[model samples]
Target: MIDPTLPLIDLHRHLDGSVRLETILDLGRQHNLPLPAMDLEGMRPYVQVTDPRPGVMAFITKFKWMVGSLVNYDACQRVAYENVEDARQEGIDYLELRFSPGFMAEPHSLDLQGVVEAVVDGVKKGTLDAGIDVNLIGILSRTYGPLAAQQELNALLHCRENITALDLAGDEANYPGELFVEHFQRARDASWQITVHAGEAAGPESVWQAIR
Candidate 1:
């Protein structure tokens, strides 16, 4: 067995995707959120990857339910805190957690800045409690189109102190990185580090566009 005491690093954990199922159920009850299922087993297939599908859409569906649970600032903070706590338990010494504020706030009508601040606050508390180091990355979803992408990037810039980097995610096959070159350039000019999710659902050309 692997040593539990050994240090580990996780570089690409998505905050929305990493939320715990128990927490989701709790949030659903506390906020009276309308979830598809009330119990864990009934909810598992909706929020967790249980099927053997070999496509990105199948994986992306899990996040739809998970994001619904983030109905308030407290919920966002709780998920961020638990994400770090979970990482610590798994022997993760350093982690870079990423999330799209627009995506998290869309269903609940929460402000993007509020979501970012809550996650940052939770990361601060979680890192101190877990004795681990963590960094936050704000993601821009290419599927949201250019206008939404610009707004999300603007929010990231406003919270640049709390956010360590900016990431591009979602539907790499349908939306190419060249569509947001200006926004990425703006982020680079602001001195923020950039990470693009490419070549996973799409081909090498997508990755090439991201790099360009």
Candidate 2:
């Protein structure tokens, strides 16, 4: 068997990734949002990661709907609160749920920071309700580059609490880590924890650069 004490860590488990389709359907009804007709057969490809598919486009699209349904405080609180209940069953303590505020923005110009704030509020609720130590991280998408990343950092600084880190993500094919050094450096200056997406798609060098 593989080493058991590898300290299983999940740097980036999308929140909506954990959401069941039934939940989406329920949310669709509650929020008066029309969800896309899911293709169950096509969805088979998405469940291949984390007990479900991690990189399926159809599954990915669901996050957009999830975001739409959860733009307000009540929805954010519910998701955050429920997440901890789910985490307890999984035995995943000290978890950090990294969210991409950039991608979660609403069509009505809902600032990226709004999404981060709502997510933090939800995370706080989850941690308190489950009596577990869970943390939230606002992941800045790499494709958006340093400017957008800095905005996320700035928002976190203004946020009251609940966030424990800021991460970089999005397609590894576009904009490698080196390009965002200055933003991360500024983050370091601000004393914010940092992480980046690497090794999942690109080479090991990508991981090295993200670390350095």
Candidate 3:
């Protein structure tokens, strides 16, 4: 039995952060990327947390491990493909995958644009392969400031068709929203949807500035 319509909407999610561990491990192995420093004790690794907050923190940290060794095209494709495949299994009909497409150059052989395109291509391919549709929304960490915002916005402008929106996340309490007003306006002017993470830990003011 299945309910065809329950009105499920996951408005905020982190793309690289949601990747499954086994998939990450497999890809890391294939790409020869070194994982984070987690000492293995008995059957479990010390950092393999599973108690809610710690679990989520440990989960997010895994991306650093996966990204550490990725230095070229094949690695990016592998990660994006694995992510979307997992999404399909969860009965996601419409999905928006968001990521901070930053500093994945050098060893990954990816320019920012290359990383964006690879993720988008992987989403499209995942739809056909997994029977679930996905759209990518590229993001920037506001703490990175307007210069990075402008670069992300410019990249979004160029890849407008693939990326559906622009978002600023990470460190909501310390960074001021007034700082990104200019870039957000630019993104708004360019017809990109803007959303930010606020009260998840802070207060209403963080979100207020974003929508303002």
Instruction: Give the alpha-carbon lDDT of every model.
Output: 0.88, 0.64, 0.64
Task: Name the regions of candidate 3 deviating beyond 4 angstroms.
Answer: 1-9, 36-49, 52-62, 103-109
lDDT (tens digit, per residue) of candidate 2 on 1-212: 96766544445566644655555555657666655544444333333243555553334554565566564555655666666667766766567777766666543356766766777777777777777677676677776776777776677666625566667776666677877788777667766788777876678999988777
Q: Clashing pairs in model 2?
A: 46-53, 47-52, 47-53, 48-53
**Candidate order, TM-score descending:** 1, 3, 2
RMSD of 1: 1.6
In model 1, pairs of residues that clash are none
Of candidate 1, the 10-residue stretch with the lowest lDDT total is 49-58
Collision count of model 1? 0
TM-score attained by model 1 = 0.94
Tell me the tens digit of each residue's lDDT in model 1 across 50-161.
7687788667878987999998999999999999999999888999999998989988899988888898899999999999999888899887888899988887788788
Per-model TM values vs. the true structure: 0.94, 0.76, 0.79
Q: Pairing residues by index, what is the TM-score of model 3?
A: 0.79
Tens digits of lDDT, candidate 3, 111-173: 777777777777777778987667777787665676776776675667787777778775555
lDDT of 2 at 1: 93
Evaluated against the true structure, the overall lDDT of model 3 is 0.64
